[model samples]
Target: MNTNTACELKWGMLCAALIFLLLGACSDKDAIDTRPSYDPSKPVTISRFAPDSGGVNTQMIIYGSNFGSDTSQIKVYINGHLARLIGVNGTALYVLVPSKAGTGEVKVVIGNPAKEVVAAGPFKYIFLPSVSTLAGFTDKDGRTAIVDGPIEKAQFEEPYWLCFDEKKNIYVLEEFRGMRFIDADKTQVSTRFRTGNGLDRPRTLSFNTTYDTLYITNDQGSWTGLSTAVATKADNFTRWTSLIYSLQTNGGAAQPQTGDYFYNSYSNGAIFKWDRVAKVSKELFRIGDVSWEFNIQFAPSGDFAYIVVVNQHYILKANFNRETRQLETPVHFVGGRRSAGYQDGVGIDARFDQPHQGAFDENDNFYVCDIFNHCIRKITPEGVVSTFAGRPRTYGYADGALRDAQFDRPMGIIYDKESGTFYVADQKNRRIRIISTE
Candidate 1:
């Protein structure tokens, strides 16, 4: 063993050691995160519910983390009531919230089979509840709604439409004027956002379920004429003020301008969109005369819209394209020239004449207001129509009894799942009627 041999051996050993250390640092284990970590403290947003039109079965959006691709292991507990996860994508969930009141806390529990790398903690769902109903259903003292109290007498009219925004404020639309917001307390209406200036009779409205857009259709106005038209007052988005959007001010058309509008009925043939926020509108479809667009409803997904052409005739689903900015042809869904009457219950094509508004069951089955037939008609998503209530023969107002069911022109409709009550806007009867369907 010479000195030269010993030195060579030492250098060789040092170089080999250095190579080994470098290889260890570049190992695959260091590059790949095979196990997932669940940090409950980091705060995973499990679910979020927005303010609604104060109806039952309000929809909600949910997000979850540490949840594997298999969704069976994740269970959402809203107020202790288990909600059915409509769709599960990765850790995100789209759920229909159980009506609040049982419990105030929202709990997200990872199933036993949940493969976790870290401990998971539940996040409290600070749900913003919505209150729409007044104390009673009576027009007490002609000032307060039966459910909501203390509404000014001036606010009462042919019944202004009530809607809600993403922020939860209610919007009230009047025919001649414009739209305004009603606070959650149901006490005061903010005229700050009024979109009426040259509008004739702002009546019906449809709020895009997924966005900040709104469609307002005025039934009629004195501004309408042969040529020299007048435009209705819309929320002055350009000026961010309450000024009316009349051409007289901008020198475009006339006071009440009619560009994409058509010759339709007063409350029947309705302008499809006419959004207040977008500051533009297009003709959705046309109907014969008054009581048209009676029982209109949007697609559950809000991708399309439907209208029950009453008095004039025809039932069609209006398709719209935001990109092309045109309302394509309308698909005739239901309605006949003989179609008449829009009262209570689900109004069917064969059995329904003048159908008003409609309500949906958990299955998305539309319950139409078969006004003329004096009964309710059920129409499935496939367009299959049937009878659910409001039989013209042997119909009377009985407690949960199928017989003796009488509805005098049932108009507007909303279902209250909590109390099993079906609220009806009995227009001709000049009162809102309630029948428990649950």
Candidate 2:
């Protein structure tokens, strides 16, 4: 009971009390949350978004107010196309742009009852290239006919070649059937010509610069001597006039410039320049044997010409001499000769299975319809080959986003620079598919 003993006991009791208080405070499980609480009554607001313009799959962050942390209750749309909600924190939302979300407004809907908020300005969505069926039955029942009318009711059998006239009207050559016409609106299809006398087994077609004349090649045997013919708009494309009757098997044709009509003969694998006015043909170059089926295409600038040797599974690149107006001896550009498979690489490292027809875009990128591979290929100016649309060797009838789309034996393709669109002739599927940015 001494003074020193009492002072020590009081100090020890106070210290123990202080430690217990500290432990109690530290052991408390409930922690303070700094997040702003979401109120159901408050309206959701979208103030703005970063990188307002972006293509499909672009991860965009939207800044706003009164957004709940629960993403399940939130939905975002660009141009009326639903976007995938990735994450949401009360004040911010993360979303991925969906396909076909063209330039348009951004809308956000939140809460159980749904409070909608539209951004003050459009998101300026960028379009990603996608493939969709322009025409044809998507069923794989092997049913095909020549019935033509509105796009939905229209039918095609073995559509091979597609060409666009000056009026943007499309001409499709069917194997057994003759010619099918598609109006610019893409709303209707009509039988322009039927397989008969001057035009049997039409193989390929091309329109003159003026689109007044259409040249179509026939697949009759070389001995038939009636493979090259022309149909004019003046005749309503009803009759074909025999341009020549040589022993060579005509495969395809192209008009490199205003007055130059060049065609390939499969029998000799020789390309011939035909003066449409005089009907005289001159040899340009020969690259293969009798087994080759060639499709010719010129670059947008006419500086390069590509020969897609169908059976050979390779592309030959030739330099077009602007001054002399002649194609130089072609060199192996992309794909491997006789070495066929589904592969993507640069130059000869690439592979193709029955690469048929191709067209050059405004950017000079060449797109080829790889028939047996069942895909469309893109070849850059640097000779880089990649699958632009359709899965390799996977054939069927499907319409959707480019990579997700399917095609069967696509035989020909042409690009429309005006609209940045590509038209594909899905041969075995008996349909015309289109690839566009919109």
Candidate 3:
């Protein structure tokens, strides 16, 4: 062969060798494992895992024997919550820590019939706080009904307002459906009262200092008519009487720990102190010429009151004079008056869209239901405003981690100090959503 011919032959041979190597590599990658399948009779065991502790979605590995190569057959659980199995080899199984998997033992189960093995050490599950549905249907189809029994089977037409009794039992005011009582254990919900009579168009509600009487706000659609009604546990909440009236339509009421009751005038922005003994009301303070449906919330210390100006899109902070039983001059605490939008900042820098109601934690941290914004707003004691949960401008029914959760026009929110949970009246969604630190 000539020089060029010899070069072509050598090139052809090198090309043939490269092709063979590529084919070999592909075959090695795609080849099925010929190793004998793991036998359940060998007994599954979890000797140890890397990192030992993790949060949701944290990848963990279990090293042991008889875990089987089939990912479907290998199940891992951290603190009783199932961990997602990513992949598995005979000796090690890879998994992602599941949400709400608190610190606890790590168990591994294998085989179809299932044999379990737990790690020698418990796994400390570090997870971010999440928002979950505590009550009502989670579907986004806008379900509205009044059914009460077990919590899982209970339903609400529209959870308009909520308050807790001394026993920690939750009293939820259903718009157009009257009142619902959720037992302290959260296992059952029952209709404490049916609508009609004086309990019409229930907008907000609260328990008296004794917790035996439930006061609810009812918008009478007139400037002067029945606005607040009450039902006592003595009567089993079967009937309600007009507690305070002739104020305005679409107002809210709050009973402070000091054993005093106050309601707002939705038309003129006046806070009235109701004297239950005399069955009368006296104007405590007025927020200038403002005219809108609003709600009131007292600080944990009772030294201040937050006025949620519904259509004005801002919150007013008023000094509470315990001796005089009145609120001092009102000033903007956060958000802009009549300036509606979604923004988070300090004081006036933050914005809210049609803020409706708020609740306070033990630390005086205020949480407001920013209705039109479709989210909950947290106003720190320092006046720092931030989105606590739910995506602003996004509306739907979702219950999961906070970042993925959504709400449609939440109308009310109440914080339970015992559980550090905030129950939300997801108005348009027609369900109650909760945010709790897990």
Q: Pick the candidate with the highest lDDT.
A: 2
Per-residue C-alpha lDDT of model 1 across residues 65-161, encoded as one tens digit per residue: 5443334666666657676555444444445555442434445666553322311332233333221232122254443322223444223233334
Runs off by more than 4 Å, candidate 3: 1-125, 138-141, 252-255
Per-candidate TM-scores read 0.46, 0.71, 0.71
- Per-model CA lDDT versus the true structure: 0.45, 0.79, 0.77
* lDDT for each residue of candidate 3 in 1-438, tens digit (9 for 90 to 100): 899997687556544544542343242557785433569678877788866776766667677888656666767888898887756656777677776678999998888788988889798977667787877774455555788899888787777777877777777877777778888878998987787865578877766667777777788766677888877889876678886667674655453666577877776778788886888888866775646768777776778888888887888888777787677778888888789999999999899999876888877888888888888888998899999888898887788887578998898788877455788888777677878753
- Model 3, position 87, has a per-residue lDDT of 64
Q: Model 1 segments beyond 4 Å from truth? A: 1-200, 208-215, 221-296, 320-326, 341-349, 391-405, 415-422, 428-438
lDDT of 2 by residue, 1-438 (tens): 999997687556544544532343342358764445568877788888765887766667778888766667779988898998766667777777776678888999887687888998888867767887888874556887887788988988888888777778888888778888999878999988888775667787877767778778876765556778888889999888898676455465554475467777777788877776676888887898775777777776767778888888899988877676667789999999999999999999999998887878767888899988899999998999999999889998788889899999998787777567789999888888888853
User: Model 2: which residue pairs collide?
Assistant: none
Q: Please estimate how well model 2 matches the true structure, expressed as its whole-model Cα lDDT.
A: 0.79
Model 2 error, position 381 (Å): 1.5
Q: lDDT score of model 1?
A: 0.45
Model 2 shows how many backbone clashes? 0
